[model samples]
Target: MDIIRIEQLEIFAYHGCNEEEKRDGQKFYVDANLYTDVMTPGLSDDLEDTVNYAKACKFINKFLTENRFDLIEAVAEQTTRALLKEFPKITKVDFTINKPNAPIKLPFGNVAVSVSREWHKAYLSIGSNIGDKEGYLNQAVDMLYDDENCKVGAISKFIQTKPYGPVEQDDFLNGCVEIETLYSPQELLKAVNAIEAAANRTREIHWGPRTLDVDIVLYDDEIVADSNLFIPHREMHKREFVLEPLVQIAPYAINPISKKTAEQLLDELRGQSENVNSGCAGCQGCAMRK
Candidate 1:
């Protein structure tokens, strides 16, 4: 990735731990590496094709002066997020803040903190089996797009599917969405759960009916199997409801565990279903067997 470097941009801001430091304020130094493609602008000699360093510097200065925090870590984190949000073309940010006037009562050159953040690709499965099913699904999509940290990409058309569990509920409207997000897997899960709560989802039974259901299907080929979350969801390959809509939005997306594409999984599932209906011997080895 091409980078634009800004070194030691000094700013006077009110950020410190003590009452005197907070009240008096001090000068802070910032260094940033803005990652993006500069080849186009270089070749065409057009300022519009690349990030405007002057504007970014001005924004950085203004941001530091406006926000008050006790630690340099907060300054770096908040500044990087704001910079990424303001500059859509920049994919990543490497930020550092320097505090030379820290009150340690001893000789010290400087105290600093650095952080790096970037955007990641993630896929989600959404379903609604109760009232206003389609509307709930659409609203979920809108809410994801509304978040500044997330950029909605491709979305599949909704398809009706029978309930997965033993619950005697109505059919579900299922779909998939592709998005680019700056949030980690845990953070993304929290955001989606908040959206589900807004749609009045209830969790009375396992795999039971819901007003709105959101599951993380994939996240940049990452494999996470914890108590609360799992990526490339546990039962995605076996469920036609998930594979069908997932294939529409991301046909070539591979499952990290099985290393199979969405289309391949769907085809294998359908083939097994056919064999079961035809009373073939392979039914014993079918995905639906157990």
Candidate 2:
């Protein structure tokens, strides 16, 4: 990634722990490294092709002066998030705030705080079997798009599929969504859970049915396994509904654990299903058996 560097841009701000410091204010210097693709601008020689550093600088100055915080750490954190939001081309930010006149007894050259933040790519599997299945799925997509921390990307067309577990239920409309998110895995889980709750989903029976269901299928090729969540979705490879929709949007996305692409997994799953349906006596690993 190419970087646009902004070094030591001075601003007068009121951010400190002491009462006197907040009242009197202080001079703060901000340094930022904006990570983005500048090759388009380099080739096209157009200002619109890349992030406008001048405008970014103006925004930084205004935000620092306008916002009041007790810690320069907060300043760095908030500024980084703001920059990422304000400049869509900027995928990541490394920000620093220097407080030269910190109220310390010992003489120090400077006190500063730095933070680094970036967006993460995530895949979600969404489904609904209850009332207004398609409406519930659309609502979930709209909610994700409306979230400031998420930028919704390619979405697969919803497909109707039979329910997974033994508990008898109606057919489900399933789909997949790709998103660029600022939230970590845990936070992303919370966000999706909130969406499910808003759709009036209930956990009355395991794999029975629901108004909406959302699962974190994958996140930045990172593996996560815990009591509450599992990345690469524990059974994504075995489920045709999840893999079919996911392959539509992200056929090349690889399972971190198996290192197999979505397309490959889907093909293998279909082959297995064919074998089982054909009564292949040698096949011992059929999904139907389990």
Candidate 1 error regions (>4 Å): 281-290
TM-score for all models, in order of appearance: 0.93, 0.93
lDDT of 1 by residue, 1-290 (tens): 99999999999999988999889999999999999999999999999999999999999999999999988889998899999989988899999999999888999999999999888899999999999999999999999989998999999999999999777889999999999998899999999999999999999999888999999999998999889999979999889999999999899999999999999999999988888889885744664876
Question: For candidate 2, what is the lDDT?
Answer: 0.94
Question: Compared with the true structure, what per-residue lDDT tens digits does model 2 show for residues 1-290?
Answer: 99999999999989998999889998999999999998999999999999999999999999998999998888998888888888999999999999998999997899999999999999999999999999999999999999999999999999999999999989999999999998989999999999999999999999989999999999998999888989979999999999999999999999999999999999999988887899775445654677
lDDT of each: 0.93, 0.94
Report the number of the highest-lDDT candidate.
2
In model 2, where do residues sit more than 4 Å from their true spots?
281-290
RMSD of 2: 3.3
lDDT of 2 at 35: 97
Mind sharing the TM-score for model 1?
0.93
Worst 10 residues of 1 by lDDT: 281-290
